[model samples]
Target: MVQLYNNGAYLLNGTEIIEDNSEANAKLATKLGANVISKDEAATGTIAYGILEKHNTSGNMDKLKIKFDKLTSHDITFVGIIQTARASGLEKFPVPYVLTNCHNSLCAVGGTINEDDHMFGLTSAKKYGGIYVPPHQAVIHQYAREMLAGGGKMILGSDSHTRYGALGTMAMGEGGPELVKQLLSKTYDINMPKVVGVYLTGKPQKGVGPQDVALAIIGEVFANGYVNNKVMEFVGDGVANLSADFRIGIDVMTTETTCLSSIWKTDDTIKEFYEIHGRKEEYKELNPAHITYYDGMIYVDLSKIKPMIAMPFHPSNTYTIEELNANLMDILADCEKKALVSLGGAVDFKLRDKVRNGKLYVEQGIIAGCAGGGFENICEASDILNGASIGSDEFTLSVYPASTPIYMELVKNGCVAKLMGAGAIVKTAFCGPCFGAGDTPSHNAFSIRHSTRNFPNREGSKLQNGQISSVALMDARSIAATAANKGYLTAATDIDVEFTNPKYFFDQTIYENRVFDSKGVADSSVEIKFGPNIKDWPEMPGLTDNLLIKVVSEIHDPVTTTDELIPSGETSSYRSNPIGLAEFTLSRKDPEYVGKAKAVQAAEMARRENKSLQEALPEIDVIINKIKDNYSDVNNINTGIGSVIFAVKPGDGSAREQAASCQRVLGGWANIANEYATKRYRSNLINWGMLPFIIAKEELPFQNGDYLFIPEIKKAVEEKQSEMKAYVVGNSLKEFTLKLGELTDDERTIILKGCLINFYKG
Candidate 1:
């Protein structure tokens, strides 16, 4: 159903694809009748290029410095972003900033800390001239889609799923520091990324939903890095066939492909979407120029897509429902094997045990969050479960609308009644299910969710506590079908049900009554609320002339998600406090990482206080003596001591800065990895003054607890050196080279100055 182009391709009038092969350029010239089209000129024809050019503040197109029209964050992130901005001499929010309380709205954990953070957000919004959406009103991306998205405008958010490309707006999900830059009137610096063309054709089949198409694309592109760090520009005839909501479902999952951002060819469907949300003036016609060139192309035939499901452990472990059902035992065996690597054998995970009479059964089904909570998805799910019942067994179902307006419309159309009548509980708009803060399943339970991720511990399971569950990602339609089957795994296509396709009616009064919008007017006289758990960042030292770092953790997993670095769920309640949250760093993946990192941190603290490192950490004397034996210049005062982690691939999921910030607060100075999985994660490392180092060899040169001494490290970053030499300090010292990929000048400065906060402090 999906095909990837291995080479560059050209889109003719947004429909025909011409592969840039041996004679394609000559053929293009002949078709255009002697008109020479430069690649740069053709690039400007893409919708993404047009939007990016409008937001580019740098004079040169090659090196873009972007200033977004607006900014957004959720409660889990806004606190840290605001704290960083405030430390950097923030006068007022330069642009419209929306802080939504969706991640930690339950206030069920950490006593009153969650609600205290909400109050802090409200008062901060009032004092800084911003907007704040209260809990249950809308999730972060939903609020942005309903109110902030505009045609051809660019928006930056602190959530990974921040995508509004279907609305003809280019939105990116980055770490909080990027938003802090925009808040401080600084530009987001980067080299212009190549754009990939996603040419769609044919309408989807009856049972196939937008998540099916998205999963198919993600499975095809994720492993091969087809669209990694590139803009995905959707085009072609199929654009008109899908509704605005369908396009949104597919767009939000684009983060799984690791793409930078996305934009689409807008039509009346999008204009009607804006009209339905009472923002018709934001609509504008956006399409590819007559001829557009792309670095790559992904051609998708929507008609052939099947009811798909991403098996446990990752969103990319995809298989059609038919295939999975046909080969249940074999697939379950494979999943069980993979679970060992993901779960670290903490608990015995068996999907086969859930199978009864050759059919797999799930305990829970959820159609919630930004991916599944849209109006059409919920209406169709309600239709599927209209008269059917989710049996009174262990199986249960819950539905969450994307926003209060969607919930209101669902109630008005009687969908909520139908769902409740069928034993499904309808809940308010919340992101807990998607990020593991709510609806935690029982031990060893299997949950089918239409959420963003299915990573381990993302379903609120604590493997360290011998509690492990699994989540398989499926479309809302199929999830509803499964619920109707009373937890027996069933695809929507297996059932014969007609969709109601009820029309959506937005209730603006719901937002007007609950949301607090500053309307860009700041009141300096307002007193900012400060919660006890909300603490300022600790002081960080600048890069030293020489560095000594002990490898605290070594993870050989193919990819380590942010949840593994620092867990979600209850840990989110402590996100406002850096040190409080840092205690959980690598708690899930490496339980002893915190103690190891803190030991190194204590040494650095002693150095800053002009105390003996041996006095602080008695174990450090052995490594320091080993280093000084060979290199006479090495000393406690000259060498900065910290910890580092080596992973095969890290930073695969989420845009939370805590993954890196937590490590930085714990005295982590660098991360050595084979490669980084996402741009946002690497940016987090840079913004937090952590060296994102890459090793070429698959075999690691140093082991855990081995100290690596690098001389003249600060000078190397200042000199723009790509490669640096380091020596393992032990009985027999061994040297290895590490590479720092291309970094912008500002990024280099941020590292040299300690952090973004320190960069501005200077």
Candidate 2:
């Protein structure tokens, strides 16, 4: 489906890929005579032009220096950001900031937690120069799509689906520490990246929706790592075939492909998107040259795209409706096997039970969030369900508009009436269902949704506690089709449905009349509000010359999702409170990571109290004495007891900061991973002052309980040293090397200061 050319290839006559390998020909002659086209000939030598630029951070990567524009976090995550910042020495909001409350709006879990986080957000907004959005006002991406995004602007957010390309913005979703860089006025440094061309050639088939296209592209690119860390620039003749809403749907889900960022060719469709959202001034024409060359190409024949579904466990496990129907039993049984690797025999998760009359039946269907809540998508779904009752069977249906304007448009167009007539409930713009706070199904329930993810716990199930549910991805049209069938999984293509949506009616009056916009200005002397449950950050220690850390948790899952780190649903309310929220860290992992990690942290506190190693713990002396007898060079070492963990892959869900900060509060010193699941998690680790280390998959030098001692660890970070030798024995001789990936300059100082909190202290 996609091909990348690593050699210096050129596009000749706009129809072929050729390497310039003729050595006998003159360099200039070979380059000029063939009507050659290269990336540099178009703009910036990248398929994505002004959307991205040089890193331009303040310091050297060798020194880990950085500087950033503004910082952003949401209520479900800000408490931890503030706590980490406070620990590292926060005074006032050093830069323009935004605190939005959307993830925890349901207030479903831990009574008083969600409301308390909201109060803390409002208070923090006042105390700092930041802006705060009250609960239910708007979903995070919708709010960003409106006021925060601008042409050629870069935004760093804590949510993994933080995309605003249709508005001409280049935004990245990372963990909280990355936001700390912006708050501390540090730059974001990254090596220049290569860009790929997503060349579209035809219009999508009738009854097919954006989610269908997104699922198609994700399936093709994800497993093979085709677009990982590369920018996807939409182009070609078919770019003009899709509407702005259609493009936005696909762009938002690109995060699932693990791409670094994305941009689309901007035209009237983009202008219409901004104009409908009341931000037309943010629009700019962004297009590649007629002869632009790409490092890679994805030739998408949109007409060939069809209704699709991503099986449980990942966004990439896809199959066409036709293929699925032909192999229902075999495909479903295969899904059960894959679930075993992830579910670990916790609960019997299956969809075959819903195969009524040999047609797969889903109990629920959802069309919501940044991916499916748009006016066009919902309006079309309403058209499909106009007078068809969904029936009061085991199957039910619900719809959520992405924002107030989208909701208002639906009401004005009679789409809401159409849906209501069909027995589908229409809700406001909230991300609750996407994260499992609302519309929870019974145990073993199978649902189809147009949301961003379907990770195991992402459906809001607590497998560790013996409760479980599952979700699958589908287009809005197909989800509606299944609902119209009274729960039997049905493909929309089987029915004839005509979409009736005119130009969208944008009602910006809601935001223009209510949203608080400071325009990047900071105001001091404001009295901040603090709820009783809101607690300050725990104390953190500065970097030591040599460090000893014990690995507390080891997970070998192919991909460790963020939902596993802190969880979503009811626990979301405590996101703004560090210590209170830490109580839930790894609650699903072993349900003992918090207390176990805290036990190790207490020893670090004792070490800072001017006590001898023997005085701190008798066991420590025994280990040290045994080490001294075997090796004579290492002695009298400053003992620092902090916990670290290892995972095959981690950080793959909502961009909540609490994931990394919770670990930091529990005394996490480092994370050793074979590879990080997403960019956000690693950034969170760096912001929390934790070392993001990498080691070979089979060469793990330390076990879960083994202590790893690294001499001159701080110096190694400062020196840009890739190979770090860590000893296993306290005083003995066994040692092996681990690696730390490339670090930006500001990153080193953040570690030395103990976290992003201290990075801003001075």
Candidate 3:
């Protein structure tokens, strides 16, 4: 169970927690006599503050400009990131960059595009002095953990799960534009984030795994936004109880809590992790000051955490497996009701049909990707299934090691053989399963996985095609226990099994022989390879004095994921080509979105060509005529036409820039939402030169396909206006207010110039 602090708390010597109540100062005085410190002074004692102070270059703690020691990206993202940097006058990488091909490793989806991306990464590494890891070698984060991570260092990745706090490294996962800035020697600008303490106590039970603990924590904090946009600093007695791998498993899932980054109190266990990976010198002991203050605290009793499951469509919809079985019908009914909201009644989603003899059955079990692919998780899974067989009757199991070195060690230690003997198919290092690229299930089938997310359509089910499947997240041990039951949902604790905890031996020979490391030496003579499908970004128009944008798609879903915005799995191959990838925008969520956006884009195309906007789209005349009724100065010359989307909450998952860039390429000028789910998503919109508009939660003034015009839009942004007036195009132009929220000066310039690319071009 997790307990949340209602008020700020102080940690005394990293063990005792003193709540910041009325008598909190008295308590601190009782312990420290006259040595008590001010709240602002004590806040600097956190491990996060220490690491950030060393990396911050702004000379001001309130506003941060961070320069990371290294950078990382995967295949589906690296191609676009390098292309953007190349366009922005990149000669050689300023910092060490690693391009790993793990997302699109399989070339089966889009012909030669996958391999072409790999080749491009290799050549870019050679041309720009970067590192490239070939396909089937290692995933991005795992490789970073093995090689790139250094204690007390900062790393920025283009993946959301970029967390190395357990290794005493403060890492952040952000959009590709952030990486491009790092490649160009630009600082990552942000306000100093608040640090939250994850105060741990006691020890986990035998059957409890890291994922269970993580899910329990996520379930408690995600909805309430307790740690949102804050750095999670782990402290207290529980820090020494968990192993390094256990801490890592819990750390990587911190992204789900919407925290900016995380850092833990590092000890000998973390030092030994670096030693095992042949980087003992990279290890550094990190701890908080004797007395520290946290804006918020999450006190987790590890012993009380049971085996939990995150039900379909979200990582926060959690329930204990025992409770789920006891209340099967009610939970299944509740899931079906939530599915109606997530799926929009696109397909008939029913979990009741999966019940047989009062037990739920699943079609597949996957222990793959960064969350479950760790050495200890896989080894324990194999131990649980040592003598048990995963029967081959409408049920299958698959395992993927996070890196080739892990695979080699698993093979050497007989874990892979034991898994294979139990009818489990073990594969190489790939992030496909975690996304939607691999192990797509049949229609309406249920899958149990240990991957990062279980969002809708992330299991490769196309809602447009009337193919829908659901996934439930569990720990690797529980998934293996379910597989042993031949897909019957079973918790690992229900089965009496002794785990043969094996000590891992990391083999780095695979990476030494296969990976291409540029060693920070650039060659100007090298020619970068380009595939036919890979293309440069299209020209974008700057902000106009007056804006006319049509609401192309309106989504009322409580939260919209990036997967629904641009989709993954099949469309990942087209990410290198901006215009081509734009065609798939909102393809699954709204099939007519591309055509609607394209229709609105035609008027902008005509405006740029100095042609008649009325001829391009006949409806523009009516919208312009209605707008001219109130403001006679609004004309075609000063007005720009584009499309926008309104959602309740948008950009929930994924750090892929395509979520916003695809909209930009399709002539999207703005996004109207009640609130943004993540900071990375809002940053993507600003980086792509799109307006991130905020509207109230009341009834809408306009529906989809209605034109809303904003006068002096560019001037409003230049003036840093908090709210701008907009008129829905109707008989008299009804008025409404749209907020721009908070924008940095650089962000305002980026919006004025069009995008990051355009700002750099200017």
Better of 1 and 2 by TM-score: 1
lDDT of each residue in 1-762, candidate 2, tens digit only = 233344343433333334435641354346567753443664354435444442344333222233434456677667766655555555667666778777777776667767887777776676666788777767888778766776666677777888876666677787766665566555566665566667777898888888998889999888667777777777667778998888888899999988877877678877877776677887787766545556667767788998999989889989988789889989999999999877878778787776777888887889988898877789888988988989988788999998887788778879999999999999987887788788888789998998998888777788887888889999899988888878877789888787786668777777767666555454567655667777777766777777767788888888888888888877777666677788898887657787778777766766777557566544566655655564445444454568888899888766676788889888899989998876667877887789998888786767787777777788898898987888786445478878988776777887877877666775
CA lDDT of every candidate: 0.93, 0.75, 0.93
Which is better, 2 or 3, measured by TM-score? 3
> TM-scores across all candidates?
0.99, 0.92, 0.99
Cand. 2 TM to true fold: 0.92
User: By how many angstroms RMSD does model 3 differ from the true structure?
Assistant: 0.9
Greater lDDT among 1 and 2 belongs to 1
Candidates ranked by lDDT, best first? Answer: 1, 3, 2
lDDT of 3: 0.93
- For all candidates, the clash counts are 0, 24, 0
Q: What are the clashing pairs of model 3? A: none
Report the Cα lDDT for residue 495, model 3: 89
